[model samples]
Target: MKMKSRFDRNFDIINYTLLGILLFIVMYPLYFVIIASISDPNMVNAGKTLLWPRGITFEGYAKILEYKEIMVGYKNSIIYTFVGTIINLVVLIPASFALSRKELVGRKLFSALCLIAMYFSGGVVPLYLLIKNLGMFDTIWALVLPGAFSIYNMIICRSFFVGNVSEDLYESVKIDGGGYMRFFFSIVLPLSKAIIAVMCLYHALGHWNGYLSVLYYMRDPDKYNLQLILKNLTESISTKTLASEGMSTDYLADMQKLNEMVKFSTILIAALPMIILYPFVQKYFVTGVMIGSVKG
Candidate 1:
């Protein structure tokens, strides 16, 4: 190992110090939220719950668990995310592979048209009308089908295919009496694990966090996804806190405290899925993003 000079040692110390500070800056808020969610909200509001829980309680969690619709929302959100991501991959991967092929006629035109559509839309009104006409409104199809595939993701996948995938492999497959479908499933997909994982993560996050489509298309509360339900729950808490005119003072105070705790708890609940899922795919994410973006 090379021995560090005095100045080099000083530089290393400074670099580590700065990195440590940056880590704390990024992580502290999330840490604070975790503690706040369990702490007594009165202590949190009073700034007494800063490093640890002052009066630790799972009441916020208990309160949220009492809501029966949470399970329903979880089910609906899971279905939507799972189905939507599958639709995205089913459409995205094959289409991107096709575009990556030099043999595809008018490929440039097709790419250009896709880019145009990505930049432009017919706007929400026309899309809503179309969905209504197709009898997809108020249905799960309305949530998952409209934006099933993203052109930007397609571009990345195509770039990966063009740059990372070799022509020799295609030629070999062709000589072995294999068509595009065989080549795609047997060769391309197996080799494109990194990019595929990245796409799955991206699409899954989008589907899991999305609530705007539900707002626009869903008419029934039973069809609501988890994020939307949490959003409504937050709003309901705020409303109750604000409309405490006739309530006893002690009751009003309890509502206000519950409101604060619920806010933190809901945020954790809403984010927990992605947080758990990301670590599993994180190794492939950075590599895929870099290669896919740089290629083509």
Candidate 2:
């Protein structure tokens, strides 16, 4: 018994060591970015700032906030993320539940169609033309509608339904004279917290980081999402044309560093809300994804 206990202790030590290494590998890059964002741009550019910041400055954050465009972009992104996630959930959850129901009429055909869309898409030009024809160009709907349904998320949710929601529960509900809507809302949805959380995280991140779709659909700069605005700002900084726009030499010099810092900082800021919230949601994702991936 004493030998077996020693073996278990050794195993635990090895396991913890491996876990610590993995954690460091994942965390170091993010830490490096944070430190670099606060350090002098020249230090960062010269690759001197890695583990710790040098010439620490909040000017980078200040410059990014001073831009009206960046502010507007933040507002637009928030609007898009909120509205888009709601639309996604509204469409995805019901669609997934419907798809999971074998008795639903034409279920197989609909599932096949959705799956086909995952592998093949109408080319970008065609999609752009369609959006233009639909008169959604330069509109917030242009960003929101095109991505309201993600087939991958739908499948994950459907799989969760198949695995976690036993048919016996549905049958029992039906025996009590419950219809699909009644059972779905009161029973299935309530029991699907984990999968729903996973879907929310997936959809929220997609909408938050999404910009190329907006770039294609939105022509007006006023309508630019956060990512697009940041892209433009980074471009302006890199090309050094920002100085030509009447910024003082001090501001310009600082702007150069500010630009570099903002580049990394905004990414950190943009991702921070979700990252902070993820731990709460992450507990659900593993179980959710696992259950969702299972066969009925």
Candidate 3:
């Protein structure tokens, strides 16, 4: 390679320096949280645990795991994420494939309608009543079925189907006497792995972290997802610990430590799944999102 000019060299140095600084700014808080979860809360509260863990401990995790409801929440979150993603894929693929076809009747009109729904929606009250009328309220269906289709995700799938898939493939299927159903299942579905993986990751992550739905429709604590359970625990910790009737002098310091730890630990616990899941889907995610952006 030819040697770069001084200007180019300086620009590269400046760009890298800026990017490195930005990366540190973004990553430090996450790093701090990870360390804080395992560190003694007294050190964290006193600002002594900033650069590295001052005192290591797992009291926070231990306390969090003591709740049986947390386990139930984990079970519910997993069920919701897996089942919900399956429904998302099953519903999205057919709709997207149909929409991707240029020869399909009312294609433009339907696409226009989908775009409109993205920009507009009825109020929360109307949505609640609709779910209630549909007999999905307080059930698992309420969590998964209401948000089964996302307009933005559907559009991405449609974009992939239209732009990435070759028209000649569909023509070949038709020439071979394959109908729409056979063509989609055999050709489009199999070839659309990247987009499907992208959709699955997005939908599954959203479902796993979902708490608002549980707060709104779910009256039963048994149905609470992990996020909701952790949220409640984090919120309740301060009040419940401070207001306990029989707290003596000796326990006060320990309760204070536990309370501080609970704050960081709750966030770490809730976010842990997504952090773990991202690396596995990252390659597919990149390809899927890139192709999904191709406009037809």
Candidate 4:
């Protein structure tokens, strides 16, 4: 019994040690980014800052916030992310439910069409021209409309419904005279929390990080997303263009350093909301992915 106890103790130690190492591997990069963002850019370039910050300053954040463009960009990003996620959920939930039903007419053909779109896309120029023709250019709809339906997300959601939702329960509901909308609202949707949360996160993050779509569609600087504005800020800092625009040398130098810091800090800031929200939804994401991957 003593030998067996010792063996179990040793096994526990090994398991914990392995977990600790894995944790360090995952966390160190995030730590490094945080440190790098606060450390002096020269120190970062010199590889002197890793786990701890040196020459710490709030200048980066201050500069990023001081710019009117950055503020506007943040507001626009918030608006886009909120509105985009709502539209995504509204469309995706019904679409996924419809596709999950085997008895639905044209299911196979519709699924095939969606799958085909996953691989082939209309080229960028054509898509741009289409948006332009529709008079959606320079509008928030241009950013949100283009990505209303993600085929991959739809497939995952449909697969999750098939694997996780019991057809028996659905049939029982149907026999009780519960219609499609009623079953969806009362039964299927309630059980589909995991997949829905996962889809929301996926769609939200995509909209939040995406800048190319905004750059292509939006001509007005006021409509620029945070990422696009960040890109512009970086360019201005690097090229010393702010100085060329009649800024004082002292201000330019300070702005340049702050810009460098914010380049990394802004990424951390931009990513913070998702990072904080992910843990609550992470369990659902795991379950959803596992169920979605298994064939019914």
Each model's lDDT: 0.90, 0.84, 0.86, 0.84
What's the candidate order when arranged by decreasing lDDT?
1, 3, 4, 2
Deviation (Å) of 6 in candidate 1: 3.5
In TM-score terms, which candidate is top?
1
lDDT of 2 by residue, 101-121 (tens): 989899989989998999999
lDDT of 3 by residue, 1-296 (tens): 99999999999999999999999999999999999888988788888888898788888888878878888999999998889999988888899889989999999999899888889889789989998899887789999887888888888888788776798887998999999988889988889777887888889888987799889888889999999998888778867876876878678777777788878887888888778877888887778667765755
Whichever of 1 and 4 has more TM-score, that candidate is 1
* lDDT score for residue 243 of model 2: 40
Candidate ordering by TM-score (highest first): 1, 3, 2, 4
When 2 and 4 are scored with lDDT, the better candidate is: 4
Worst 10 residues of 4 by lDDT: 236-245
Q: Which whole-number lDDT from 0 to 100 does residue 222 have in model 4?
A: 98
List model 4 lDDT by residue over 116-219, tens digit each.
88899899999999999999998889999888998888888888787778888889998999988889999999998878888888888889989999989999
lDDT of 2: 0.84
Each candidate's clash count: 0, 1, 0, 0
RMSD of each: 1.6, 3.4, 2.1, 3.6
Clash pairs of candidate 4?
Answer: none
lDDT of 1: 0.90
Task: Give per-residue lDDT, candidate 4, residue 63.
Answer: 63
Model 4, runs deviating above 4 Å: 1-26, 39-48, 241-256
Q: Which candidate model has the greater TM-score, 2 or 3?
A: 3
